[model samples]
Each structure stands twice: as structure tokens, then as C-alpha cells.
Target: MAVINNDSSVFQRIPNELANSIFDFLPNRDIKNLRLICRYLDRHVPLRFNRVFISANPLDVKVFLAIANHDTFRKQVKELIWDATLQSPRSCGNDSDDDYGSDEDSSDDNDYQGQSRFQRGCREAIEDAESRLVDKADGNEQQSLLDNLMTSGRALSYYERLVEEQADVLETRADEEAV
Candidate 1:
């Protein structure tokens, strides 16, 4: 039988640095499980799983948001993997003839009956993530991951060139428009 007690000896046996390293590679779900194991472990897991890779699926976003809502250690995610070529639906109408399934109409009150539930969950998650970021920023002197990426020399130069080209294009367009 395993006993749960606050004998520092239990955790002291494992080195803190090693524990953090182990925690770093864990998937979000596993990380949450490990956190529930003990308070000492909880202290080490950062809020919002800071250095995460979001892919094409919105489900990843949903799960991350779900976890980030409750975690105190996660920071405001600095890098978002934006799909440059994401496709949007051309029409919102429900197609009953489709083979798989049909979507409910946006105007249907029954379809939106659970909307408040979804909204509440999303709101709570954002608020929690915001709080964690504010707390972390207060103590850290280093630039956030987002700031560093935006201001780096290569990125900065690229944007500057792009802006100059845009300005020239805009000036030419204005001349044409005047004519």
C-alpha cells in the first residue's frame, strides 16, 4: 500500500532539476496528472504549458484553453501557430443532403442553447491565462517569447523592408487614384 504524507523525504529523494526536466516533456494531460500527484510537483509545472506547438486542429486549441484556465504557472502563450491558408466555410446554411451530417443553423435557438456554457468556459480560461502572465511578467526581467521574436534582427529587417515596399505601393496607388 502507498501512503500519502508530507515527509519531504518522499520528494527530496528526487532532485528538483531532474524533476523539472521530466515534467517539461510530458503531454498536457500527463502534466496535469503529475500535478495532482503532489503539491511539490505542482509548483514546478508552468502555467499554460508555455512552449507548446499548436497544429492545424482546433481541438488542440480547445484542450490547451481548457487546461490553461486552471493552471497558475502557464504564461500567455507567446507563439501561436497560425495557419496561413486556413479555409473558411463559404456559406452558413445547414445542408441536409450531405452524407455525413448536417450543421445546425446559427439562428436556431435550440442550437445555441448550450452557448453560454461554452462561453463561460472560454472566458474563465482566458482570465486565468491573463492572470498568470501578469504575475510572471512582474518578476521576470527578460523579454517575453513573443517580444523577442518580433524584435529580433532578422525579423525586424524583414518587416522594415516589407513596410517600405508597402508605403511605396500605397503612394503609387494614391497617385493613380488622384488621376
Candidate 2:
């Protein structure tokens, strides 16, 4: 027999086994919020985001390092996996016939449609940035505009460097060293 009190914490009202099981189903974000919400939940709920992945994307390694360095999560981490999937533009496409998919058309309408979100966003960002700069400059030299474009990822050369840095981090086992 169990006693239920209206004023008690939801966890306190439930059986310990049930409460523990609920933690397993909670989403990572919810778990984080729960931990921050109360010390009781923090001590009771085991770390569920135990597996961390590092990929060519800089964000992946950054997140992995953040979790690996976490005081509580560091002790509970079970696995560190490397995601070898390279971040290439248009990574997916309609491959009904397969055969390496379609090549660029002269019109480029289909090509634009086939581009990944990352590709489109990067292009749009550069265009938007250039437009804004031009508006502010009131006809500054074109060379300065070109330099701004160059620094703004320079057609993804900056992204390539980030990928190279990620590889270096993995090769150096920086994530492992963080714990």
C-alpha cells in the first residue's frame, strides 16, 4: 500500500521503481530541465544522454566536448562514437534511377532545387550580407565587398577548415582527454 499526498512532489507520490523507469523515457531536453528544476530529480534521474557523437560538423564536436567536460555527465558517459558522415552539400537526392543521379542543367533550376538546405542558406546569407553592406556603404569600392564575401566563408573554404579542425580534434582525442 502507498500513501499519496496532494502537496508532495510528483516523484515522491509515485513508487521508486516507476519513477526510475519514467526517467528512461524522458527526452534529453526534458531531463536537463528536470535536473535543473530540483536537486531531488537530479540525484534520482541517471544520465540518459550517455552516448555522444562527433562528426565533421563543428557543432557535433563542440557538443560532445561540452558533455564530456560536464562534471556529472562525464562520470556517466558510456560511449563516444565518431560519425564519419562528411558534411557535403546536397547529401541526399532523388535516386529513383540511381546511376549517380542527375548532373547540372544549363538553366540550373533543377540544380537549385536539388541543393541542400545548408547550401541554400549559405548562398542566401552571403547575398543578404552583401546587400546589407552595400546599403550601408552607399557605394563603397567593390574590392571591399569582395573581401567581405571572402571572409564570409569564401564559398565554404571556412567550412572546409572547420571540418579539418574537427578531424584534428578526433585525431588528438580531445574528447577523450576532456573527461
Candidate 3:
């Protein structure tokens, strides 16, 4: 026999606003699932889902050019952050000796030049990306760029977390060393 209650409503009933709020914080994969639930619910999410992230990948010029040419998803991108792992060869500024640091002032000039060159290269890259934005390029190019962007972005965030952890570890080690 089937059991029936006259005062029954819904077992899993949640307020729409509350549900949307909860769903917003869910992972991207879960969000995809949530979107499949209903079109009304999917409309609540922002457009950021369409844009991709590529943070730390060592990208070649061609790969960079490709991402700038994507069609449907490209227009949704508000900003693109390229974290090229370009660093100066000299860490002499971090040296403890003041006199030695002062003596190596010329090295600072070299570092400045290196930095300017790097900045120029980045500017050129941005220009190139912008130029490719309107072209009817190969769809594969955009996909490759999207992959690189996601991979790089993930790697950068991972490294940032690792650096924070390392800092904490160093502090603990220093305390132990001092003791």
C-alpha cells in the first residue's frame, strides 16, 4: 500500500534566492550541473563563466595570437592577464652588505634595461592579441590558447599558495633556529 499525507508540501524545497546564492559558490563543474536544471536558474549566473583563465603558461607568440582570435567566447572576456615569468638575472639588491650593494649600482641599470625590454615585449604582445581579435582565424588556435590560459592560471595560483605555505614554514624554521 502507498502512504499518503494530506499536509504534504515538498521535501527538498529551498527558497529561490537562497538556492541561487548557494549555487554561486559551488565549483564550476557543479555549476554546469546546476545550469542543466533550468533555464530560469541559469540566467542568474554572471557572464564570467564564458571567459577562460591562463596565468603562468610559457606561451609562444603563435599561441598568444590564437587566443586573441576566438569567436563566441572571446567577446565575453573583459580582461586577460598574462603573467610571463620574466625575471631579472641579478638578485644583488637583496644582498646584506651596504657597500657591496652600492658598488653594484651599474648592475641596477642593466636590470632596468632588462625590465624595459620585457615591458616592451608585453606591450607588443597585447597589441598582437588585439589585432587578432577581429580575424576569422582557425578555431583550433583559440582552443589551444584557452587550454594554455587555464593551465597557466592554475599553475600560477598553485605556486602562489605554495609560496604562502613556504613563508609560514620559513618562519617556523627561523623560530626553531633561533631557539
Candidate 4:
């Protein structure tokens, strides 16, 4: 049997329709790894890892802000997952002035109730501190801080705007096809 050597590249020989069909069957992690194999794959693989989880924790907020500011990454993002659970520091159970109950008469149930109340208080304190920091910040910083606070609604709005923009692009492409 004679060896067949096609002048065209393997990827070029495969139709984009077939490539997309194959890509659909692959898991997201595999797809991401496949994208690194060649420029064509890199460009053709639509963003499957689209969800961006943003928690109330400061570090996660920082990451969310970074993604929001990035033009290309932000457009690829489809969902903004918000986790609003407050992350409080572990208490030592020492008799500090901030302690909710006196150590003398605190039973197990009362201790649990007190801890719950303390957690709520901690959450409120964090919000108050953040507000104070925002107030002290200069014009741009203040705006950024406010944006971080409103990120849940703002992220949704941003995603909606992106969808609208994509729709417009599709419409323009369709018009070109018609012509």
C-alpha cells in the first residue's frame, strides 16, 4: 500500500463543523487542554469554563475585580456566581469586652446562641469597616469600592450587556451573509 501524504494540514483537512461536533463530546478540562495543541483549536474552542464564583471574602472579591477589568476574559464569562456567606475569624473564647456572655453562667445552649449572635455581629462589623474604608477612599477608589459592594447586580448587568453586544455582532454577520 502507498502512503498518502496530503499537502494540507490535518486540522485544515477536517471541516470546522466536524471539529465542533467532536469538541462538544469532550469534557471541559479536556477541551481546555486541547486548545493548547494549536492556534486553530485555541481560537475555535468557545469558553466552556464560563462561571466566575465571587465570594464575600476579600481575596475572592479581588479576583472578581481583576476579571471584570479584563476585556477579553470578561466577554467570555457567561455567569457570575455570588457566594454571600460571611467568613468570620475563629474566636479563642477568651473573656474580652466584645464577648456576648459572661463566662460564669454560660451553658452549652447559651454558648451556641451567643456564638450565633457573635457571628452576626462580626458580619455587621465587617460591613461597617468596609463602608468606612470606602468613605475614606479618593474619587476613583471610592467608585471601585462601591462597585465591589454592588458586584452581584453589576456582574449580572455586565453579562447582559455582553449578551446584547454579541447579539448585535451576530445580526451584523447575518446582514453580511444576506448580501
Superposition error at 14 for model 3 (Å): 3.7
Q: Provide the clash count, candidate 3.
A: 5
TM-score for candidate 1, residues paired by index: 0.30
Per-residue lDDT for 1-179 in model 3, tens only? Answer: 23223223221366767876776677778766545554544555532334444432322333434555756445666665544343233243533432222322443111222233233343345447646665645665754563344332344356556555545534555322321
Q: Model 1, stretches more than 4 Å misplaced?
A: 1-9, 47-78, 83-179
Q: What is the lDDT of residue 175 in candidate 1?
A: 23
> What local distance difference test score does each model get?
0.46, 0.61, 0.44, 0.54
Model 1 clash pairs are 46-73, 46-74, 47-73, 47-74, 48-74
- The C-alpha TM-scores of every prediction are 0.30, 0.40, 0.23, 0.37
Higher-ranked by TM-score: 1 or 4: 4
Q: Which candidate is the best by lDDT?
A: 2
Worst 10 residues of 4 by lDDT: 106-115
Model 2: lowest-lDDT 10 consecutive positions: 102-111
Which one is best on TM-score?
A: 2
Better of 2 and 3 by lDDT: 2
lDDT of 4 by residue, 1-179 (tens): 23223334366678889977988898888877766665666666765647887643444555666677877777877887766444343355652455454433433211122334343444455457666875464667655654445323343356456555445534554322321
lDDT of 4: 0.54
RMSD of 2: 14.0
